[model samples]
Target: MKNLPLSINTLSKIIGKNCIYVDKTKMAYQLICQPGAFFLSRPRRFGKSLFIDTLKEIFEGNQELFKGLYIHDKWDWSQKFPVIKIDFSDGTLKNSERLDKRIYEILYDNADNLQIKLNLNRDIPGTFGELIRLSDKKYGNKTVVLVDEYDKPILDNIENSKVAAEMREGLKNLYSVLKGQDAHLQFVFMTGVTKFSKVSLFSGVNQLTDITLNTQYSTICGYTHGDMERQFSEHLDNVQWEKLKYWYNGYKWLGNTNVYNPYDILLFIHNRMLYRNYWFETGNPTFLVKLFQKNRYFLPSLENLVVTEEIIDSFDIEKINPLTLLFQSGYLTVEKTFTRRQRLMFQLKIPNFEVKIALHDHFINAYTDLVNEKIGLQDNLYDCLEQGDVRGMVQVIKRLFASIPWRNFTNNDLADYEGYYASVLYAFFSSLDAEIIPEDITNHGQADMTVKLANHVYVMEIKVVDNANIDDINGDDVNVIQHNNSALKQIQAKGYAEKYRGIKGITVHEVGLVFSTTLKNLLNQ
Candidate 1:
């Protein structure tokens, strides 16, 4: 209940900033025991930077920050160690020589602080090994090395293979410096969003414990339930709890740990708004748009996906493999992991809703044809729900998908495309969520679309029009509406509409759309 202070160096000083110094009293303990070398991987903005900052304070022996906090009285903060923090959050490797220059600059900067100006020329290894040997003369204690965002280079050019590989190699060279300096390094902690093979960076640096999967340190990166309960309980009512969960609570750490996104959670509680995809824009993002497009991924039912290891284990950067990357990076998490016997097997669900629609806005961009419709999807569907117009709602979707550039999708892919379109619609109907079944089974068998909002259920039949599905149907049935008698019969025989029989108000609408056509063409047909 005590107030936080505002000093930059003192954790206590971070007052009025929603500062959460989760009694890392245990950090002091951890430092005493496993103080040798450590590495952590979590998604960006999950508090890796803040963790390092806190360590800097602790190691500096700033007892002021610890006042009344767990480490204050418990620690023998009597000794402050010399710290050398290397932040890779901004540095990059574009050219071979430039990377070396950046490496030399980092070494030179740290060395200059100790007043040891040496000639950092071409011949020096410039590895962490060489730097530590040079710094040992000036500082009494072994250095505490903190490298943040260590994978920025690799992330930057995931789309550009040549550049990504170049960056990877350069970073590998720079990290090579860390090897063999174990003698001079008292503590080493590196943080990244990836758990990349150590062979990529530290080939010789083994025995570096990966604390990422370690449940004990799970709260070390993001806000835990207890942290929120203890620190943010009062602010809970400020925003819709369901919306909060829908947007940010999907990430899981350890086995059972449910963690909230520190970035979104803080901004949400801090600003008190339920806005869309905020963090994605602020950072350098290549986006999962292409990935979604390639996988023919739907925006609505992504949350319900139970991914196989084949689907989730690996992905290419340009592909935006959301399953792999999101889970690996933290946007999506192991909501549940199924195992057989004692061996690890497959399948994962979206840990929660916070990340369900992370790809929504990204999809809009990827589908080039979908830009300019800034409709948050959540808003429009809810608008129709409030009006209780089942027919109008179906018409809205009919018109929505009808406007897309369908050339990108084939006839068979129409249902899949419409699934995403409906999912977007579902997102808008946030308030009436329980009613809408994304891939609902209706009287027609499986309705390509069935939306139940505001106690009204609508059964929809969507057929894709192209040279293939439509032209042939036109030839067979001669019906202007559904094409062939076969098409109409299939809809009737399957009983796709039967499922919606008693759901309050029921409406049936059949719509056939040509997505790639222009507005003029769409309006005419």
Candidate 2:
């Protein structure tokens, strides 16, 4: 087997080094056939930069690189376009001024590479347009522009809205030049982790077609199962194929195929097939988790989310939808698409086991004060549930709820709402990679949550009561509460566990939890 190429994204470098190349030139040829501005959105490290580099090589007429590739005999080798490549994948742009400086540097580098002298005195926008025109004029060919991580400047400051908006406008100025330079451009392709609304960032370049959801080029970036079986079979001989797929392969784009994240695949093999959260560890989703916590997002809803196209399409700096951010950032993926009332809707879900575990683990950090101690508690909780020790599970969970710092509840309305507790439970269970259904629908009613483990299924109902209303009952027997229309009584009365009772080899367990706002912990379990 050839070298994995690891983090090497340069097309020429990979080919020259005899590394494992997935051969995306066919898609590149197809994309280049259409001469127009285009945009693609994909999660970071999903081979977007490599795809951009592939396009760059193809347009630069590097015919030798295509010797064994699909586009070798298909393209005109003599005609090479002046390639102007812009990459924002490196470093952070704190404000508009820093962004402009980076743009100037990029333009200078491109001009120097093409051996064209740039007029330093021109404004940033003028300088950009001049670079395009001069490149076209000097090379006797229209420029083919390719941009990678076009939104990184903005995304780098997403936690700070003001700086992010400033970065947006700054990029808008640079990208705006693309529209006027359209006459001198042969092809344009820009890729990023997130897609900003046209009105917000691409108003001037409105003609750019967004192929983010286009099925034809859905496999343009990322590795498919076929790519693995054909290219990396040697490296994966000892690995369990199904286990590997379960951990890393489920990302979809409403296309015929689902692809695995290349980074995960490379590292999984590099690390001796140890199934760790390699790709996820590279990113910090603290902001995303904070957003979820602030919004009190129901954790289990992510398992089976249904949203309209507009919801997942694009977001502006003025309004960032957590769901869109999640989907665009690789935390969530499209499971399927269906039409609802003449509008397209998508069913989104956590892509695979790695994400389901890592994402919810992050959520747990944001929801509770367990911090680094969560692993032990999680193990204890899992053990209890695995052994069907309902009482032990409740005690572990009570410890979990009790671990939350007082400040999380002080002068806050979190304890008054049952969602806080449910969200916590959902995160804990999901972090274990258990199948969890929030608001589980049954014939009688919707259970607060349903947790499905190896052979045990837990049907849970949660009730929140202000401590002031039950002051006298604080130290009373929890069983007494169970007898008086308690959460468990509600489950028993409504028959929430009936749906899972008859499943072969599955034992259904009903559990009820009562939380006290004043006590800031479970009063009964």
Estimate TM-scores for all models.
Answer: 0.76, 0.97
True lDDT of residue 340, candidate 1: 65
Residue 238 in model 1: shift from native, Å? 6.2
Poorly placed runs, candidate 1 (over 4 Å): 1-20, 25-28, 78-80, 91-96, 115-119, 122-127, 134-141, 199-206, 233-248, 272-277, 284-286, 295-301, 307-320, 345-358, 374-394, 405-525
Report the lDDT tens digits of candidate 1 across residue range 1-525. 432221222343463354555565575457544457887878877767777777877777877766667666776787666677777676556665766577677767876765666665544354455557656656676777778787776776666767766776777766666666777777878888875555555565565777775667766766666676787776664556666666667566556767776676667665656566555445543444555555765655653556565454444443446567766665566656666665554445555444444444445445536556545433565576556654355456545555556664555454434454454444444323434555665433575555665555555444333333334312323354343433344556687666556655655433333332222122111
- What C-alpha lDDT values do all the predictions have? 0.58, 0.89
lDDT of 1: 0.58
- Per-candidate total of colliding backbone pairs: 31, 0
Model 1 CA lDDT for position 404: 58
Q: Which window of 10 residues has the lowest lDDT sum in candidate 2? A: 467-476
lDDT of 2 by residue, 318-357 (tens): 8889999999999999999999899999999889999999
